[model samples]
Target: YLDVDLSLDQVHLYLCEYLRMKDLEGPYNAELVPVVTKAHRSDAVPSLTQHELDAILFEVTEANENPEYPAVAVLFQYDAAVAHNALGVTGKAQWGVLAGYDRERQLARIIDANAKAFGRSWSVTCEWLLQAITGYGYIVMRHVGRLLRRQSVRGSASM
Candidate 1:
């Protein structure tokens, strides 16, 4: 069983397989787009190159049928604030999700799943990402793909 704060790598692996199954069903396919390091994050400034970032943006933006917006999220480790907005765990290296951007305020929008535990402590400067990340790991920018099919098949029969 996965703890609430499951490691991002494990979650990503499960998701990639699930999406691959969906793609094989001949409805929709959301392939892994960005190339990143296979190892766990240890780098201080995990980042996405301009070309990769642009490609993700273009693909997501092109999907006019997307419900809320693009299905992409930026995952990285950080020195999360230990005060009230910690990532629901102490002692563990903090991680956060880059969901959206606020051009006006100039901040990378952070939307952690444990938002309730930490409150809505979102929005950090691009500079914070550059300087605060834990290591020099490559960024894992992912698109949480859509299933053109009906509901999610979540049990033993899902595959």
Candidate 2:
């Protein structure tokens, strides 16, 4: 029922703000504790502690279901790690954006099929939610870039 506009940047900002409010730090926070713990506890490259993985899973689940923080799901799902694995970070950002578009189209088809099966209209809000989920990854990165630019400008101005 949220009036979501499917802009990647906006989605990212919403997610960043939501996580900030929740005091969840960011997606990387979950990994940090475990990685550090493993560095000391074992010689193997530190893997996520069960607790860290659980936190990430919980966030992903909440983001997928909650309209208010749709970007969180996207961030966790298509992170830099995934992007790097796919095409390396050289053009990963662009790839992520294009991938989001593809995802949106695919999700739309699925949603449409489900709606038909249930004999319900694919209402505007439902469409919005679908777009939010599918386009979440691109949006989060865009949002982060914008925020960094703003901070840079402010810092320069202050100097």
Alpha-carbon local distance difference test for all models: 0.45, 0.30
Superposition TM-score, candidate 2 onto the true structure: 0.23
Task: Report the lDDT tens digits of candidate 2 across residue range 34-56.
Answer: 12233245655423333333333
Regions of model 2 farther than 4 Å from truth: 1-6, 26-72, 75-159
Q: How many backbone clashes does candidate 1 have?
A: 7
TM-score of each: 0.49, 0.23
Pick the lDDT winner.
Answer: 1
* Candidate 1 residue lDDT tens string, 1-159: 223455556555765676577663243333332223333444423334433333332333334336464444445555555322445455544555556555456456666546654445576665555444523222343343543221232222322
Q: Give the number of the best model, judged by TM-score.
A: 1
Looking at model 2, which ten-residue stretch has the lowest summed lDDT? 92-101
lDDT of 2 at 145: 13
- How far out, in Å, is residue 95 in model 1? 4.0
